[model samples]
Target: MSWFGFGFNAFGQISGRDRDGNDGDTSIVYTPTEIKCHVDEKSEKSSELRASWSRRASLHLNGGRSLCLAGSNSPSGICDTGCTDAVVGESFVILVFPDRFESWDLDSDEKIPIWSMDVKTLCDGAGSPFNLPLIPGGYIAMTPPFYRPLSPHLKATRLALGAKHSVLLSASGAVYTWGLGSHGQLGHGSLSSEGQPKVVEALWGMRMIFVATGGWHTACISDGGDLYVWGWNESGQLGLPSRAVRKAPKYQTSEETVVTDLPTCGAQPEGEKDTQVFISIQSFPALVDITPSSELKTVGCGSRHTAAVTRAGDLYTWGWGQYGQLGYETSRSDEPYLVEFFRERQLRVVDVTCGAWNTFVSVVKKEVATS
Candidate 1:
């Protein structure tokens, strides 16, 4: 069977492989550098097990300068090593065994694990469970919470996957969700799995559009521009008073709570309404999207802060700039403050993507007026 090797270099190149032999097509530039590779032992032998070459290997440079790899042992046994310039407290290690998935915090050297069910258990005497043969060359993106799809069509607009997890969208001033929906993120009141696209039942009759997911918690927007959140509300991520998590997921179809409930007083102007929002409620403090207009858009989560982009194309960030992931100049605050301020304020932003801690935006240039 063939093996898979995946990783990102400093120049932002991605590479990977699965059981099938390698073709050079899996290379991409400026993609997230983190990588994962899988191999199926059922495949034949004679596959060359070797490290894939990278065009821009220099980008893999880390302050800690350590190199390590881990996975099932067929080509070789478990591989781990240490190198120079590697950040002592920032790197992570992953180990995949035949039956278990383990992740490590190399900085602290702690092992975190997730269990993988045995093939028999997963199959229940069936031939086999649904499994996708690992494609060795897939790239990885460094996303917050988890790696989520970011469609350029939904730039500045928020989108998320639900529990019965489906692709959810807030576009053209309406909420649309399509995918698994044993949970009510689809907005259909009944607890049923929707194989095809359909408007949410509770939201079916309303002019509401826009949706966000924090694991199970979901939030949506209405045609009147009001916000509605339901599903798992643990840790107040739903911005509602209810602390109980919903088991039989359904769209909580009322104006139950608004986005304003998320931020404390003075986060926004009085009587200023939110036009669009995204919620990421994975852990700690949940993320809240605050888009006042094309010019004023902000995102914040957790205990220490918030982030916003001014209409002028300037990026402003506050709250939890500790890791410099906020793209700020320094990390000295426990409260909200501006970290990165762009000098060119007239640029128009076509899109913004925010992870758990870092945010990315695509902008377009504007012609200057010649006086």
Candidate 2:
């Protein structure tokens, strides 16, 4: 219910202070601190925080039926089996392994239990077993990945990730995508790369509820709010002023004699010129035009920047703002910029989050109407 963190904390993962209480510059905090939640007298407390990363973080409660994780310590088991550091129970899935945290068990295959001290004396069956001191972290549960592939009835409501690609949003609004599509980011206009989940047929009838991803680009938010974008727009971050890959003129068999490789600037300056050029990358989803009445409620991404939040709360930002994180002082932008520092103090930024370089906002102070 209360958490806040800023970008990169070398490894203490936002000051969990393992390297001697972080007295020696673990690197970068730049503001928004306060993210310290740990209380496991042996597990069973998480209330819900979902997912995060600066080092690692996760939590869940009955809806997901209990789950927990807490930063740094994945010794190459590839994030999730024996969760090499911090772990919590019931239906595991947590994955992210650049430095720590791993899990798997969705049902069980046995190998679990690794929080040491002989699994806390086999969960306190007691024979005087209380020497617990392995807190350097690591836990191992098993099971999970059976590869259902989708279509049992198609129920996913929302999910997004985009360094490697993956988007899924169906509760009927349908819009699915699968891993790494080179650059098309799986919108499917074609950079081709999918293993299973597919659906985005140029947004079929269009319903998309919400989705976001950056590093390679992909964004979606429509029920009527509208705002779509596609794969990597170099720095425009898909506010789309221009970053293209349009070269479609392949043979339509005419009688007007049309030969083509289509690149001629040699001798034609008379009256017709619409050759259409620019090839930076944008495979499919493209419809970003904020302020045609502004309705967006949420969207986030950063590995290249993008943020949105406005059901009247206002907070917009576009790609790569160097270190200012798009709040201003401008280092980069492609259009959507309205960060006025909590609208100059009346405060109302409801929510926005990102951290490939930094950005996190969530404000609320605005009530005043005295007699």
Candidate 3:
């Protein structure tokens, strides 16, 4: 008998494990060619596994619609989509291992060719793939007209993979958004969703370093260390006081009541003299510049929760904890709270990742000194 396993690494590398726990020496590094092959193979295998499990799990779970892994597997080095199939739609979710991409459709149980171009073709000037999987109940939508052209010198680097929603940072420090803008996550000054990518006029030339999107809400970090949030604030997830959701982006000033409107301060250019504010909100805002400060280095967002890692090797989390996703043995909350499990430890955290509910972090142990 042979044991088989599939996993993904922090650097977006995926691998397969056979009975011997060794499978072809890590799949030829992380190049475009190897990545495509890895993804295709994984997607095929995962689709087959899901088809088999859907039959057994649905019967046992009782009224269970489907199964989905719904978490990031990159850092854990383990990739599994579980099983997902429901009357609303009959489709099997496929993840091409190691490629860090996924595909699905309503018609068939087998995986389909969502992308025509291979990795090499995409990397060159050929074209890119469109593999955005549809969210369960969400429908296809588009955003209103808003445009900001990129600098002629900065060629558009097409997306290597297709995502229903993506946070794109341009070379000129602007953030371009597209896909599923209904929740105002696109930051296009409206609630309409968009199929094609559009430049966020609000963040035009702002030198945004990072951007993140939750189911509906969006968050971003400026190069100046200030944090901005917009979209759904129903649970005070925007770190704002009001319950009303805003259709445009707003800056988070302090730890005030739940905010629902745009920030009092407008978007400022990069070199402006502004007080630095670090406001952590539910879901991924943009990637923050953690270099200047020695406290934290990386951060990530889950469906309704957020996580961050400090340079000193500490981890913190806030928001919904229903599934023990916060790594704290407690119930969910509406306020941001520190995860006590890693408060005083000196572990060296190398990476962090999040899924809709679960969080994964990689760390290296410190060597102890002996007399």
> What are the TM-scores, per candidate, against the unseen true structure?
0.32, 0.28, 0.48
How far does residue 282 in candidate 3 sit from its true spot (Å)?
12
Worst 10 residues of 2 by lDDT: 126-135
Q: Which candidate is the best by TM-score?
A: 3
The sequence of per-residue lDDT tens digits that candidate 2 reaches over residues 97-128 is 22333444434554542222323222222121
True-vs-predicted CA distance for residue 99, candidate 2, Å: 11
Mark the regions of model 2 whose C-alpha exceeds 4 Å error after superposition: 1-91, 95-183, 186-189, 194-229, 232-237, 241-281, 284-305, 308-335, 341-371
lDDT of 1 by residue, 11-34 (tens): 222243311444333422122112
lDDT tens digits by residue: candidate 3, 1-371: 11111122222222323224554434212111111223232332221111111111110111221223311221111223322221111132333322233333323333452322112222221211221222111211112111123344333332111124655555566766676655556667666777666777766667666555555566665666455565554543454432322222257345433333332323433543353322222222332222355354555555555565665666655555555546655444434455544443535555454544445555556556899
RMSD versus native structure for model 3: 14.0
> Which prediction has the highest lDDT against the true structure?
2
Task: State the C-alpha lDDT per candidate.
Answer: 0.33, 0.56, 0.39
True-vs-predicted CA distance for residue 64, candidate 1, Å: 36
Candidate with the larger TM-score of 1 and 3: 3
Q: lDDT of candidate 1 vs native? A: 0.33
Error of 3 at 128 (Å): 15
